[model samples]
Target chain A: MNDAPVTAPPRAAALALGDDALVLSHRLGEWAGHAPVLEEEVALANIALDLLGQARILLSLVGDEDELAYLREERAFRNLQLVEQPNGDFAQTIARQLYFSTYQLFLYRQLAAGDSAFTGLAAKAVKEVAYHQDHAAHWTLRLGDGTAESHERMARACGALWRYTGEMFEPVEGLEVDWRALEDSWRESVAGVLERATLTLPDGPRSGAWRAGAGRQGLHTEPFGPMLAEMQHLHRSHPGASW
Target chain B: MSSSTDWPLWEVFVRSRRGLSHTHAGSLHAPDAEMALRNARDLYTRRNEGVSIWVVPSSAITASSPDEKDPFFASAADKPYRHPTFYEIPEGVKHL
Candidate 1:
């Protein structure tokens, strides 16, 4: 007599995706009231909202979204190391966006085409991530080719974030995206953008001890602890209180 | 044109639906037309408020000054015949 869908929702996959969205959303939200320009303030906030929406959906599939987001320990988060990196500068933020959004769009496209628990979310999110990728790409090009200082900053941002790009292609459970193909596509697309932006690619291997990221395994960076404390403080302080 | 950033101001218009005219949403700063359009999308359409957006450089637009309001808009203000209300509705005609 039980008629619920037989597929148990994949907890780990949901946690990973949810954590990625939540972490990146918070990072982007950090730009509120601080973006270099008014238009960019709106742009970054919109992107943050989009990521927050995705995080809410994905997190709810695994557990109480508010609790999961607000109560998780530093090491308990399953986001990629790339997203948890601080928003060092405008150029750095754009570099992170360019890498992450490209991978997200590619992965979401595959998820949207498949039969899975994530299909509906992926279908909706793919369109949003497409715009995110375009926004990042647009900024990357502008910064890379704009002026000497801007170009230098853009180049440094790209190189600094290059290490974290490898983890994006790591396969998650319950999703059927071809990781290798997605990685290849991501590389080609990013390489094309960088070429047009007149920036050089990083020169080191992305998977060795120096470049590998373990945020997928719940390992985060030094900055993550403080960022999480800041994000979760209000919720932890006002438990069960409704806005 | 007045600031150190040198970012130009662009006016934003958003069309909420098909067959409807694009209405003025607001304005924002951008370095160029491409960024202006993207800024318009993010700023004006974040709430699903638009399907299409149009951006125009504020400097490119010419308008009758508010000081000329009497001469520019006064004629239309008193023209009652310009509205369809001047025509009588035939017997059972509705919606007109």
Candidate 2:
């Protein structure tokens, strides 16, 4: 590791954000051959590629991208629990996408408006995340209102994913975005999408002991370890080999 | 959960750039118009191939049958005088 004179705070922020993108990109990529339809396969892959691009940029700011992605232990990752969760059914995946993409769009928008280390990347990434948010919102609306079975699955997924969302708005030391405003905007937009979809806002607790995440402190949930092993397998198997 | 077979087929059209007409791309299945547009974006524009997309239900389109090709197009084919290519333009003329 190159121990530079840069302060600890920005490095930590970059790792947190970068890991979120990397983990979620991997999760999305897992759907490459398995999405419910051909169109969905293309859609999910594009979204995965976009997130991977963002992750590479963000991780490069902190350290070697390959090492950060493939060599780190599970405990070393700082991704949100929401991103690391397995792709359950399609509805669950959409619920996760809706929640995280909404938060990411607001966060990037806030960062882009200010002069920070993140400003340039945030400005560029905000547009892509806007599309991602729109995609998730569209699917949520479709699945929520299409049929009784779809509505039940969608509603259940929304409730299951709700517990992991509070961690997104928690303050990071170096990032300058206002956490409270971000949380409020995220809630308002998500609620609006859910209402328009004919789905109710999840009644699950967001910030109390019942909450489901501690990822900001490098703590993750149960699913991350196996996922990390799979993601790192090729890179780890062939040390320094490049195709 | 609707089966994949239940989704309706939509024909995709793409405008590759500004000032261009949307051309037929391909087809994909979607539950509704909104999803159809999004599916077209992902399927047709993944390589920066399009600037805009239009999705129409395949059932909504009316097309000429290939079996009627000679009967349907023979009338127009014989009207060779309608072709601007046959017009003689003076060498001094610029665009004509």
Candidate 3:
């Protein structure tokens, strides 16, 4: 689109980050009307709105936000596999939020500290992501230490999502971040939260034949297709539509 | 979805800005005071509606009974001196 903001190199990084926000926003929005409590429903929706705002800004840097969001094929999306994973259960959703938001907070903090194109957005977004990380961490602590059932569910969710996390540390073109330090900080922060929550960090391989990491390279997992279909359905049904 | 009935109800108080007394915002169910504070932030202050928040367990409050409305409060209605309505002589004062 003519209104696309950045050029090719930064475009990759923007799309990668934007897609993560957009996809995760959609997944979190799925909690509407179904969260365990009214308070939780509001909390999740508020967080989703914040992510949606960030997604809009990030995606706009690449191209027309609507076209990029609604017209992209499933394989074209560059979101992390962890974000595209289904919202299995409440504890599972919290686990996903904990992992992703912690990474996002660290990534944005690093980006904000640099002189990159992402600095402005990252500066503002870091505050929002801090709240998101806190929300996820608090929930993790409560659920992991609450009842036996909750603890088991939280543990299972954490284990199931562990393999997808390594993809987050991979370097993106045009972003000036120390990937190793980012990964180390992310691991330390997440491990601390998990420990305080009384949950163990899953010791599975994060990147290997059995694990996932290709989403940034325009590859996605099985659930991403259906998610994109549902997300894009409305815009595709009515071309050039606006409300 | 887990049952929220097991969680205790908390009364939320929010101070809209500095120097203002915290007023009752609303209530929500949460497992503990910490979660209740967060829930209060989401429920009542998401739109910059507060500068501070306080969450108290609903069970801790001893509320006056509606059935004793006259005995508990109506006796003060006949006393006119208790009302601050006689101090409107100044022009610039507000929120008095």
Prediction-by-prediction clash tally: 0, 0, 0
Ranking, lDDT, top scorer first: 2, 3, 1
What's the lDDT for candidate 2?
Answer: 0.91
Q: Candidate 2, residues B1-96: lDDT per residue as tens digits?
A: 456688999999999999999999999999899999998988889789998899999999999999999889987977878998878887898964
Q: How high is each candidate's TM-score? A: 0.91, 0.94, 0.93
- CA lDDT of A201 in candidate 3? 88
DockQ ranking, best first: 3, 2, 1
Q: Give the fraction of true interface contacts kept by model 2.
A: 0.70
Model 3: per-residue Cα lDDT over A100-127, one tens digit each: 9999999999998987678878999999
Q: Give the range where candidate 1 chain A is weakest over 10 consecutive residues by summed lDDT.
A: A1-10
Clashing pairs in 3: none
Among all candidates shown, the one with the greatest DockQ:
3
- Model 3 Cα displacement at A130 (Å)? 0.5
Candidate 2 residue A31 C-alpha distance from true site, Å: 0.9
What TM-score does chain B alone reach in each candidate, compared with the true chain B?
A: 0.79, 0.86, 0.83
lDDT of 2 at A180: 98
